[model samples]
Target chain A: MRKTQPYAFIMPSLLLTLALGVYPILWALRYMFYDYPGYGSATYVGLDNFARLMRDAEYWNSVKNTFIYAGGKLVLTLPLSLILAVILNKAFRGRQLLRAIYFLPTIISASVMSIVFFIIFNAYNGMANQFLMKYHLISSPINWLGADYAMLTTILIAVWGGVGNYMLLFLAGLQGIPNDLYEAASLDGANAAQKLFKITIPMLGPVLQMIVMYAITVALKGYESIMVFTGGGPYGKTDVMYLYVFKQFFPISADTASMQRFGYGSAVGFASAIIVGVVTALYFYFSRKMDKIY
Target chain B: MTSAKILTLVPRTILWLFLLLTAFLMLFPVALTVLGSFKTNLEVTVGATILPKVWQFGNYSTAWKAANFSRFTWNSTFVSAATTVGTLLVTTMAAYAVDRANFFGKRFYVVLQASMLFISIGAVVLRPQFDMMIGLGLQKSLWGVIIILISAHASIFFMLIGFFRGIPRDLDEAALIDGCNFYSVFWRIVLPLLRPALAVCGLFVFRGAWNEYILPLVFTMTRPELQTLTVGLAGLRYSIGSASETQLMLAGACLSILPMLVVYIFANKSFMQVSAGAVKG
Candidate 1:
């Protein structure tokens, strides 16, 4: 009875987690081997979906785009966030005000921000192009979401919105460091750059490692921004792997060529999940190896 | 001035300038939105200006009716509230049990719950999710939306576990000695102490459920009546025929975001706490 009491307390969560969390992966894995349109009965086609995933140019393009998009987000966000964290860590007038204002975007809903960006980047009357043209930066209005710049636009929007939280995280990590370490380093005639490289970076190793895993995973699995902003448009030039799988299931547009490839989509989804898992694992493994002996 | 003073002053000026620029950039869009919300459609679409010539506050009423936000806001509130309450109740109970009691499979449950924080096999599971819900005849139900919102939320449990651990066990023992069973001790003693944690958890979960789009979208696809605010906004047609309705879309967007902004302003301190490693804000 005593042993069972704990189980009783956790029973609801356990059941819900299994039903929603674990079951979906298993069911989707099973679905991956079959060809089912949304309504029709699924037909088993073992390994065919996987084979087609390899051969699918569009799928591969999506994979490439996912990496580029995720990579771009990481490249733009993490370093800038780190810099903001460092700057915000210092004592200054209006520090709290600046911090709060910068944090404003992170609290706002992503859909709201996406809509806001959409208006700002509107083809006919975008503030970005208008400002650029006003400054004689361009001859005419450039389509920010055109194929040439869609992914870049998506990446910029992501960086704009996501930098705040990561900055906060870094700020937390920075605050956790004992002040004595910096003071001790300064006693040894260390300059600001040396103190940063030698003491601060070394002390922040574990946090940095954790943040890398988080940043990479977040960037890799990002779907919401793309879904709202571009919808993987301009002939799928801005398409990412996550959206590829989603479009497979939901069919966002009227185009129905790949609408019925439910099994193939499931295969893509599972495959991408696996790839992400492997990448996350590899990151952990290598980061752990070089995790700073100090 | 001395060169030393000049050097320090230059960097200080540059830093302040940089900070102010970023602040302006951050606030600029919001300023435009707030200003543009009161603009006519032609002004919003055709001209790019910071302020409207004729402030049309009616845009709010028009957009509110156009999107039928009153109904969708109700949907968002009901579903999000239920999910937040359920999540808090369930996770708090689980955390209380794990913190206070000895039990079989406890280790497995804790580890499994924490693992969800990182490894999410996302996007691949939507159809299976749909199939499962549809089979249970829950695809069109508001409860379906609520349940889906409540499910797969181990992160809250993870956060609450910390809160529970911070609680002294002596409190539980004292309550237990006062003619209280384990359940009473939890309900009467521990649950009260968990209020701050609950507020953080509730705020986090409420914000998430309120803003959630795709899951609710897919689950309630068949039942337009059950659509949440985010999905409702997505489905709403801002214009009827040839009229460019940027104002309405902007208005609706502002309306959709108003609740969150209001919540954030009130909970600003809690949000800051959450940001600084309290709940991974």
Candidate 2:
């Protein structure tokens, strides 16, 4: 009993994590190589699912879409959030209120918020178009949800949803930079842009690296909003990798032609996971190299 | 001196303008949602108006009924609460035991947790996870999602472990000397001391469970009645059975945000502090 006491304390979490967290991942690994339709017996189809994955156009398109989406989000969100964080970090009236308001979007459920966005961006009589048209920005409503602009629309919402969380993160990082650095920069007659580039950006290197890594993984994994917003619709133009794989398992979308293909999905999932893992590994490798260079 | 002062004032004015504009952009969608909730459908679709001609407070009740929000809210509350409690218990105890005791496979367990942190299989593993639930006979209810949510405690486990290390071993030893077992020491001494950590982490865990979309979305697919608020609210687009129940959806959106908003308002400091601390490690 004395020897087993520690095990007893850790057993519940150990068992649950093993069962739910670790097991499912191992389970996916095993299922990826089989011809399992989720109900019938899974036959050994060693590497066939992967072979098909290589040839799959839709899956490839999703990979492309994932890059575009993640890239768009990263490009927009990093700069925007950093700027917001910098501005909000200063002593000002209503700073807390402003920070909270910015952070508000981060806390809301993505799917629910995406539903609101769906309404706002609705091609006809939507708030966005209405607002734009009211100000005579355009004579007619742009089909924001149409295939031509759907990806851009989703990217905008993604940036909006994400900018705050990153801003808060930047704020945290900003707190670490000593005021003297900025004061010293001021004393040296550095302008705002110059200080931002030479002092702020360099000072935020490690934190920014982590944030960018985080942003990349999160952007890659994001599908909830898009799932709710477009259901990977308008000819699958907005279908990211996760949404595509999700369609394999849930097939909730009316447009998705395939039903639950567990084997192929597991394979696709394995591939997608590999892609994300590679991206993450490459980021770490490059960031470390940059560390050496700097 | 006057030119220098003017230069400083010019940038200051521009900064203020920029900050105010961003603040407006950030608040506009949320504020609009609130206003739209109280607006007539006709008013919402029509371009000119920002607020309802007459506030339709009844839209809340109408949406609440139409979206089955009460049931969904209850489900969300139950699942989130259960997940939070389970996560706290599991993480705290495990963290306490790991920090305090020398156990078999301890190194391996630590390595496993670390690997789990980095090796994210993501949504790909959902099918297998669901199948595992089916194997356990938990696939039919919200319990499966709750269990999955609880099991994804690697981050929390690590966080609690950090918090646990801050707690002195002398206290545990003293408790042990006072005729208390390890369990009682944890329950009576350390657990209470962990209130702050638990509260911050628990709020986040609750939020994650509440805002979670895909797991509940998939698990509750067969049972519409089991859907949580996020899933239910997302479904409002189609389920309202009209060309557009935009007002109703806006109402549901407001409702879904309320509980979290309240939590954020009260524990605003903790939320900010924890999130800031999270990145340091």
Candidate 3:
């Protein structure tokens, strides 16, 4: 075979990738320097989009919200799923059935999860309010998707919708550990907690890195659920980075934002992508370093 | 029983109980949605009943027709099928070339695929891509959505790459020595060996494309006729304004979820094994 044969084989995907992924990224970078109200009406306004973003309170708030959501999901999901995986790892009746049930959420469409969450947390007679009020946990039904509670509600739903997928990953990690390690630990008189900390965690270093990276990236980029559930608001409290960019193009309502700033939104998107890229790269680099140390 | 045995037994039983409760909590929301589809929205929201008092079977039909789910499903099927075929062809050739073909820029393709997984921010690209799609005359068409869906799913490489690496390179050489061209070697020998991986990757691509929201939503915004199941269901949520029609929404959600759920159950073990392997890899 010719040396270029491989190139020929890969050209289709590479071209598609270029068109879909790389071209858009470049287009975004170019759009950053312009004032694009809509197509074919762009004006050369170099650095203006960047200047606006520097002072744009709403954009910065969305950045802050992205971090909060991402950080919360990372902190909440990793340990939660790890513990669940550990519990499910034990020899018990109905373990397979339970495992399947836990994984069920991962299979459901994001729209469905969003809808269910929206209804459950609906201010009036929603199941969440009913459940909480039933237990006297709160004085009254809280409008969970309302401005005051939107971020919290959004984060919880993200966790609920996401945990099952990560739990299964953790479960796979647990199953990968050699039985002999646990046996040796048992011989050393290690308790369950000790075994978890010493054997399971140390063994799961790579998986932990993978999961953390996934959780952070997912949390940062997640918008569909929030869009469906809250529409990024009661105000703009629940707006994350991606949702902010998305709403820039497709505003919450037509009359409210008649002038869509396509150029500005693209600049924000480009900048956020850079931030995410750097953070993700930092995570990968440090995790690889951790691998070396271990 | 001895106190030692009883102590272990007691804790084991406690653990079992705790796990049982956690599992129930996990399943409760989804179960409620499925069950709620059978009842009026008032019963679902106003009361927390495990089962409907009188099962409302008409909700599914009402949702099915009202949401124009038949159109949605047809579009979804077209997009998903096209995506699956395109992805399989692209991934298989790409994987083969990367694994076997000792060509220039081999390293570049590998790195490119990896970066595709890492640096993904198509959110910003929405405008340009939309414009480009229009330029290409694919805007607001299933083909536009299908093309974009195929591009977005680089993760299908996860299973395929791993599987390709596992196959022996000697087979490729043997076919080459048999006077076979690269395509024949790939098609006749390497591709046959990839049957299992193909099955796993195909299902994943199909399912991902089926569930995809944003791409379809944007591409089909002007043409609701081209909207996928997810886009339709999302629209259905707002259209069912009053709580009286909430069951219709739930039933619609059920309809959207049913195909994937049924497929997952049937392909349960294969799916689990493939994901487990993919994650570990």
Candidate 4:
């Protein structure tokens, strides 16, 4: 129980974070200012790489793509998860079993899920199209992986993979609400809808904020599924910022001449970090303000 | 009374239908994969059959050899197990210290935990961390990947520290009154009491490490011998080539998911409860 002994307890994790977390961030910052690649000596570029990113069309496309993906996911998935959570929160028979079934996808690897979705969303010979056609919903299969729907396809898969985790989160929040609040609202002649709006939504503000923050962050970090399904392909229609960064560093082709853009890629990476950081900070500011208001 | 009864039945029926539909949507992809795992490449692509014409259990064996899945699974198991143990030990000690031991930097530690709640740039950190790993001569090794998993998981442990802190200090004091030292108090009293939190944190770390793809993909490039299941599965995707639909690869993918599915089914309640509690906290 010595005063200093406890420091020994915390030192291992703190040191690990310093080595693996803090050090790499610093290294990335340093690398951004230098022209470094997987090979060759790094040269100090002094923001030239960043300056070049201002004019790079692909970087801008990726920025636009990242925002589109993040926005689409937030708009679609957040409301869906909230609705699902609200529905599942009601007392019903077999609810626990249903909860487990819904949560199964979130526990599995995204790579595995992506592959499964690839099959389901395949242009032909996939079950999804077969079902649609069988039901006479459409004459032909939807081109899910084509340029027009590729990004949408990615977003749908992301939403499907993600909704379960957030639903559980909202379920917890719903459970935390005291029953007396609902009783009071009922006594005031509030309908169920009115009670949900006045009592539940207001009380669940913090959890909702947390969900939005987590969802936005996840949307911004959408790489794994895109990597597996499209490889940002069918002519880069599915390309997002993270995929662009990956391709820059680890180009899949044999042409080393086109692959030596480490400085520019690092610049792009830094730009992405800045955008994500800004978005996260803005979310916090708004949430904190909302917290004060609520 | 009769009108009320009718109203209740309508809502209950609708709720049941909604829940059933949602559950079906969630479970359909997994069911398809499991069903497809039993079919041949020809049967998989040429037809739209819910049940395979002939169940080919041999696909499992084929995928096992094709992807060197045994070695990949071994590598994944070693990394995940080591990371889990490392995370538990480090997080437990840190949580114990942060929660029980009032120290000079308690406020700073609290801020550190809160900051961890926002640290979601693990993918961005991978490249630079790889550079640092290379500089430190730990690149292209399973140990390096394990270290990365442990570090990336520090936030979860930090959050667990907060959870542990919420537990009453009276328990620790009672243990001390019985002549238990700090270690004994932590080992016997606090750790046992924190099982719910521990299980939550442990499973979260395990699943994160197990399902991780990009980190291993980037870091373990030189050592193909050290690839994890995620990376191994990605490689398998290409090996099956244009000739194969998802059904051909479904068997391999299902095999990959079996370990997780088994773990999830047994521990589903604990997993859900703990994770839900953690998020709410």
Query: Which has the greatest TM-score?
Result: 2
Candidates sorted by TM-score, best first: 2, 1, 3, 4
DockQ of 1: 0.61
Ranking by DockQ: 2, 3, 1, 4
Alpha carbon deviation, residue B156, candidate 1 (Å)? 0.6
Candidate 3 lDDT tens digits, B38-72: 99877878876678999999888777777688888
Model 4 C-alpha lDDT per residue in residues A1-100, reported as the tens digit of each score: 4888788888887788777777766666777788876687889989888888888777678778888988988888877777778777777777788788
Error of 1 at B195 (Å): 0.8
Sorted by lDDT, highest first, which candidate order results?
2, 3, 1, 4
Q: Estimate each model's TM-score.
A: 0.95, 0.96, 0.94, 0.93
Better of 1 and 3 by TM-score: 1
Clash number for each model: 0, 0, 0, 0
Query: Which residue pairs collide in model 2, if any?
Result: none
Docking quality level of the chain pair in candidate 4: medium
Name model 1 segments beyond 4 Å from true.
Answer: A187-191, A255-258, B237-243, B278-281
**Once model 2 is optimally superposed onto the true structure by TM-score, how far is the C-alpha of residue B35 displaced, in angstroms?**
0.9
- Candidate 1 residue pairs in clash (backbone atoms < 3 Å): none
Give the per-prediction TM-score of chain B.
0.92, 0.94, 0.94, 0.89
Q: Superpose all Cα atoms of candidate 3 onto the true structure and report the RMSD in Å to 1 decimal.
A: 2.2
Model 2 stretches with alpha carbons more than 4 Å out: A289-294
Supply fnat for every model shown: 0.55, 0.71, 0.60, 0.58
Local lDDT at B181 for model 3: 83
